[model samples]
Target: MTAATQPRSVNSAAADDVAPIVQRLRETYARWTRRTPIEQMRDDWDELFRSRAQPWRINGFEAGGVAAEWIMAPDARANRTILYLHGGGFRMGSIDSHRDLMQRLSIAAGARVLGINYRLGPEHVFPAAVEDALSGYRWLLDSGVRSGSIAFAGDSAGGGLVLACMFAARAANLELPSAACLMSPWTDLAATGATFLSRADVDPLHQRPMILSMAKAYLGPSGNPLDPLASPLYGDLERLPPLLIQCGDCETILDDSVRLADRAAKAGVAAELEVYPSMIHVFQAYGELHAARQALASAGRFLGRYFTEQDKRPPEGRGDTRDCG
Candidate 1:
């Protein structure tokens, strides 16, 4: 549970290294501003990143009276499947914005990743997203995929959803995944992390007040923002599968991942937490960035090891789950 050694800065000219991309992203945000309500931001993101290479088959499912798209990797036939949850502060984002990342993950895990376009908030709050995530998990299980062979992965809010699903599975006495991975999870939606203020200038994407507003919108009047299922860092972690968490040291949510790992370890869960230095929030979106590529490489390696181990382990009841647990 101790912190991994901080990665060295990739370049000395920090401003020169990030300014153009940041500026471009800012301009994109401005353009999004012109189109109000902000929920439509996912549409803009889907359009802007539409050219990214992600060849997948689309399937549909019903949740909360809404149809959700499941994007599955085309190459998958017999390999295991990963159910991916997309992150957008529980408000914006879709399967498309995360398509490239999930494609890489699908390739790395040697499995098809099914990315869910879950219901977002201010309209569908709290358990709405949680229920949709579980429904997606159930769909995978019902489709004949062994639960132990399946994995859950996500980034930011989706990362949080990953933990939520695991907790729900455990509570329901259902089978858990062989492994799970998260990228800078927003685990503590209550905005308890001090980094929100101290790291504001350095962290990109999440400005504290903005995230708080989104959190409030997602929680609604009946929900408790601190409920462990809502804010997973505060949840029980024992009996969970091997966990892989990756975070940028520069993000406001940095502490969320760090603390979650520490707590998971304390609760006897096997956890690996990697912190990439000087990277912004969900930097993996910038596949061209050096740090992003490195992070993905690390993720691929970790998943390869876990999947290989899973392949060796016999089925539960036939063999001890405790060894892998």
Candidate 2:
């Protein structure tokens, strides 16, 4: 679609608009994961993006018959908490790979983030991830953390989980967070987006057939891939908190975020969508990328509005220089 026709703004001259650093990132991801197996892909991710931040304490907890790592900022006693879910296509990724993003988010949101290391698929499949997410939220509530002060965030598959958790939470009559944010979220696990094929050549990380293979592995012989919990784009979107979604224009999964915004808007949920030109999937992982910095700054501004701070002024009071767009 042309930039003018799109629901949100787009830089059509993305080739020239994108920074050289992002170009290098595309090259790096292509070189690193070319023809690699899913397991090796996870290992490579660990080797490449592993956080060097000093290890902080995470109170271990059990939920839904699985163990989860809950990382808390040292000053969490006063600040609020965010429950973060890491994305790896339901078969990969861990809290360790997402540490940097979570740390940045914690600082931006003025809250301690609890990153959950949920169980993967091919062995645990479908409802397992959703069950773990609900269990984690329940644990947070049961532990005396006020629900209104908690926010949910995630990327890719984790993004889908955040929405699923919202669905489950509403069903159970739990209090919701003030707002939420998603980065390059894979809302449609069914891989039904036209971009999956249209942008195949440009998308660096994901390929349609390969992702379908992984989904099959996770679902096994008798699983429904289009189930709402698995593909939350197919689920109900009403009653969700205000949500901000950041996506890259060039990624194969771009349609996932687009469809989500459309669905959410149709359901009357407050949704703000931002699409960065010529950006790759989860480009925020490369902190040096200009688009990554822009996306993070956008997320920070959005969070700052919803997550009020005791000493800070309201977003409107902040100078216009901080505007994301």
Candidate 3:
């Protein structure tokens, strides 16, 4: 709900270390009570990125028929790429809003980051954003970026979008990326998880009405939430690449990642889920927070190893997972 609501207890001293920062984030989000128009929201999101000095270089790319940017840290490898999709409920986020986040992730994972500004909703609607993301993936492959060297990543809605792209890619007979790392993935568009109610008191960003509104706008009036393209949670998960999903323990969408992991594993996919204690949605976006740093580092290691092994080896550790609270 808000930072004023105390979080459910956790078992470790690390939670104690991260609790204050997490609470502060919640308080900040709680203060975001007023709703702005979509354009204002986009501007405001970019302002957060503009307020700070950039730690990496950013350049414009061909966009592959969709707006996109290329981000690289000093140590980023050209051959390795992370196809990044920004999360804004499929209606608002841009590459500018997620530039720094991509930079940090690129450095951590030792890969070049390609961030795309896919079509947003209430205008473009469902399948449009998904189509743009698929375009980005297709461009990467056509440009000679090895499918094994590519990994997909996104936060919140973007997280689910990347997964949806995987399903689309497979149906089109395109080689899937080596792996994916979803930050607080919004896998369930229907908002079916029990945590929507249980964690509502502690989660600062999401609530049912707002969630459903975003869903409706992205889906348009006629789109079905259960359509595999709209919500990968309902899709057949077999033969999809490995996945690493990270979500805050206090999120309303906590079970989105939880349920996705459970189903992915059952359907023969490698899905690892990490629930960060006391943190709110997309904690990795707050690079100043310790939990965010730890989470990104973990995701970096996860993707780095996979990037190296994707072309050279078999998926031997496909079902292994390391869970944390």
Model 3, range 1-325, lDDT digits (tens) per residue?
Answer: 2222222232333533456655654554454545756676667666765544385545675556887777767766666789999887887778888888998898899787888889987779999989999999998887777899999999999999989999999999999999999998888899999999999998766898888888998999889999989998899999999999888888999988888888887777877777888888887887777787888988999998788554344423211111100
| Sliding window of 10 residues with minimal summed lDDT for model 3 | 316-325
Superposition-based RMSD of candidate 1 using all C-alpha atoms, in angstroms: 6.0
Q: Mark the regions of model 1 whose C-alpha exceeds 4 Å error after superposition.
A: 1-16, 32-35, 55-77, 308-325
Model 1, span 146-244: residue lDDT tens = 886677889999999999988987887778887888998999988888788778889756787877888888999888888988999888899888888
List ranges where model 3 is wrong by over 4 Å.
1-36, 53-55, 309-325
- The residue pairs found clashing in candidate 1 are none
User: What TM-score does candidate 1 reach?
Assistant: 0.85
lDDT of 2 at 219: 67
Looking at model 2, the pairs that clash are none
Better of 2 and 3 by TM-score: 3
Positional deviation of residue 121's Cα in model 1 after best superposition, in angstroms: 1.3
- In the range 90-121, model 2's lDDT, one tens digit per residue, is 88888778887876676666666777778787
lDDT of 3: 0.81
**Candidate structures ordered by TM-score, highest first:** 3, 1, 2
Deviation from native of the Cα of residue 241 in model 3, angstroms? 0.7
> Which candidate do you rate higher for lDDT, 1 or 2?
1
